[model samples]
Target: MRHYQPGSVVQMVRDAIVGRCRHIAPRTFLMVAAAVTGLVTGVTAYLLKKMIVFVSKSVIGIIHPDGFSLWFVLLALCGIILSAVFQRYVVRDYVEDGCSRIIMRDLRERKYYLKKRDMIAAFMASSITLGFGGSAGAEGPIAFTGGAIGSNLGRFAGARKSDVRLLIGIGAGAGIAGIFQAPLGGMLFTLEIMAMPMTTWAVMALALGCVTSAMTSASLAGFRIDFPVGSFSDFSLGLLPAVLLLGLFCGLYSVYYNTTGNIAAGLIARVRTWWGRAVVSGLMLGVCVSMVPMLYGEGYSAMGRLMSGDYGVLGVNSVFSDMATPPSLILLAGAVLVLKGIAKASATRGGGVGGDFAPTLFAGCVAGFFFAQVSDALFGVRLPPVEMAFVGMAGVMAGAVRAPLMAAFLVAEMSGTYRIFFPIIIVAAVSYATARIAERVIRNVKSCAERAR
Candidate 1:
């Protein structure tokens, strides 16, 4: 082959100059720009949450409070109708609200706009899911929307590729922090889950975004427990076995949540019609929801039950194990988990858009309750289910998202207790490692299939 032309060197130099101009835009400017992203996200999340809560509490209360009685039949019908319409018509083509789809469509530049829509939509969707009773969290929706906006802005603003990517990451971190009011959790969430490889730059930006958003949210919300999980003491030599066992058990429960949730999503996906899926899911969930109101919404009421230390049927770990009873409460919890998984997974899979963060906590609480009983009978250890419930919540959440640090930190922040940090770390590590190994197995299988094809 002939030698390359001398102008090749000139072309390379031209590209370098353009890149320098893009990255050299002052650091101060970038920080301020990114901080604006946090500011807007914080305001939006706060306002939207209030509106959703108001709708759920005030508007819905006035409409229907007596569970599908003849007095509330029309309201239930309207709820079903709205659910069907939105699933069928509006979010029909939007399967998964997945980042992969957004990227494939070249939405890097359109992220800012997407964030706005996502935030508002998450607010409305969460309200509907909770208000009339679908059972989910606003965190996922908020995160998705925030990430979309930040990512799109980068591309649209003509920033360097690295800058765009970093900004997108920061946006996701900001959303997590702002909504949850958990700074360390938000930073770790980005590093372990959102960012691809966890680089130094990503850490810096993520930390900045999280801190900024959390502070903004705190200032506005007056710094209370945004969402309380659980906590424990006794990280000393005496409690090693219990702590380690907690981790192992939590990992197993996380696996259950992930596998079962996926199964529900698969079922919904196969239905071929969004309305059919929605109606079926809604009805299935509705029937059981009448039994254990804890199985509905974000399950905050269930959490309250746990905090109150009541071991009765309505209590946190109070699974109806009687084998008698009309609609067996034990079977009811299992069925509710399956159905709730569908409501959450299907929405994400079908394009209604959101995340699976809340499901793990629900599963964890249930497992903690179950394990509490097991420990008392089998192991003869009186592990307080309330505290262990938080551990389970963190562990499952860590495993599902592959964010061990965030999971551990989330529990600590919720309880304002650092005494159990060491144990939390251990449990988190186990949950994350186990889930990662499992994920790799699936990934490798997929790769092998693709190569064979």
Candidate 2:
């Protein structure tokens, strides 16, 4: 104290703060860290989204206004090449689908760590992929990035391995909540899909993270509902049977979707070179986009247009003189439903750094629209297609991810309505049941085939 210098005083104060932080209870420290992580994750999600939009407008909008042009192919090729270069040079041997893998690893090993370079590489790669019409979604990469941030932060704070895993979930949930502006959905997604134990502390941490992220995102991006369907106001008891049927169909479709994705991924995996895989996938995706322009990118804008009955905007030209014919519309919508699954699968398989969440939602929209049209045509059911589309979204998500509660709550939050909760629950339950049955059947078939061989 008698020989105190300015530098020594600053160092002493820093040491005192560090010492105080070290003495803080683990639970209190976790809670505080989680809040900060959520805020940071929300800001990251918002900025990434804005960047995608800006780049998309600048690259795709200026070059290819009609959604499907030769420019689309060229731009996609360039994006893929650039992503490969970045991954190779900046983040060596980065894992694909990093979020899902991280969650699985954390569950199995109860340890989590993600390098800062990997996080940056994922964010950059996904932005480039989506910006150039890669036919994928941003949710997966964002979630992974959030988890990386949380894991690194927790490690720096000297958290235990188990608590670090929980922190990863907290950050991931915050990312989802920020993107969708649905805090409950984000929390449930982490708890259900990630299979995190539902301890009170875990739930508290996830909830706090999701709420903070959602609030931050809302403040920055405004509180606009994700999917706005204003035409469907009321629910009808007569729709239960129809909703059940839709759920069953959605489950079957989900199985087909999963199968197609696996097949495509396997085929693409045979190509050893990243550049070759990127080029081939880019070319194939380009051809598909040229044929069905609506299949480009995340397909959210097209879904919104479909919900609002703006089919032309989606490049669906009417063939019949009477544009109101349900059959013609049904055929177009069905084609989209089928093609979209294939295109999205192909895109993901071909080195596109994106997630299946948005593509699944896109397929759900097509299925719901097709169901409404078919029911009106065949069963004389005048159910609103927009409402059916929303239900289909929940059903497909439940089946594909096997998380009915998460799907139901997510759709409800996205729609900003509790009016359709009953139908959402019914559809989600049935879809989940159907998907499980389908999985068992496929397993049995495969076992029988192997035995015969």
Candidate 3:
């Protein structure tokens, strides 16, 4: 009913549709803030890695009476205890959880721009988790540090909520990318795992921010920081069926992962007393640390060894049939998986403020290791366990996030050559579907049981 201005109609329409694009006078300030957030996450991740390696080396050196103090073991023990203590008494940092907390905080709460003071506390919490030989990964802390910087910065800078969320994703992606030197994976992960089902425009914004942050982090760290990955063999056409089979196996395992994780979270939530939970978790972790040697730290070194070749035979006691038997390492891998679950749940319940994604990834990798071994035994043929291991990684991750494409892309971008990309895709898709079906079935049973109770 309103008459449009003679020539102002177009301008009015544009204003209504596009909204006001506030630039704040287009100052370099916002750009700098974003870059700074990325840098902080990157530098923190890099530094964290170095810190763990340095302290870990010292710990190993101190193992002797005179010259060798075996301080690494003591440090490990202390670090484990301290982590338990921190979770219970310190930061108390569990917010939204499932995939990663950083994602949850940024998207759900609009807590953009991480504050330095807040980040340092988170850094300490994660450092203790790694220092004490706890079976965890660095991704959670990296994301936490990144998210804090982004959330705090945005809050201080007065950015729009959308912009702030993007910044947090960027920082988180950068943090993870820098550590694994997997820029694309980090970017995709932030988009796929961190953000909720996004609109096209929002997806573009998130992906761009995450990717840029990852690239910046990689530039600061290195073009590609090489770490030990699993041993991948030459691809053979004969392995296609096995690859598909392996993918399905991983999917089933992923259901186990998510289900157990939910149960663990529920268990922690049931407890009311923080210190009581912390002390109990600490004692449990201490006993686990004492009992299992490889359950400590990031488990990278162990993962590399397990993936480099295969240990044949069935069960934990089997000798390598050749060098590709994965079955024999099941017990060892299973131990790490169990302790990681305990450490993660204990930390959340007990008081250590952190995310569970890292622990989940670590457990997934170990589960993948076992899956590859079992597949080799069942078929009586040695497929490329290395590639299978990587497939396992994506599969487990897919279960958590329910994003098969992203999971596949994350792994391929991180590790696969051009040649193996398609195979990785195949594996990830199968794994995702498998996990989804199994999850539905398990949830149905669980619901029924609860109703009966």
Clashing pairs in 1: 94-351, 96-348, 96-349, 96-351, 109-152, 111-148, 111-149, 111-152, 112-149, 129-134
- lDDT of each structure? 0.60, 0.77, 0.59
Q: Which wins on TM-score, candidate 1 or candidate 2?
A: 2
True-vs-predicted CA distance for residue 444, candidate 1, Å? 11
Q: What is the TM-score of each candidate against the true structure?
A: 0.76, 0.91, 0.76
- Number of the predicted model whose lDDT against the real structure is largest: 2
**Model 2 CA lDDT for position 12:** 69
What TM-score should be assigned to candidate 1?
0.76
Measured with C-alpha atoms, the lDDT of residue 76 in candidate 1 is: 29
**Candidate 3 displacement at residue 450 in angstroms:** 4.8
Q: Please, what are the lDDT tens digits per residue for candidate 3 over residues 367-416?
A: 66666666567766655556666666666666665777666666655553
The ten-residue window of minimal lDDT in model 3 covers 313-322
TM-score of 3: 0.76
Per-residue C-alpha lDDT of model 1 across residues 199-305, encoded as one tens digit per residue: 66556666777777878877787776744444445656666677677777777656666776678667766778756766555554555454444554566556556
Which of candidates 2 and 3 reaches a greater lDDT? 2
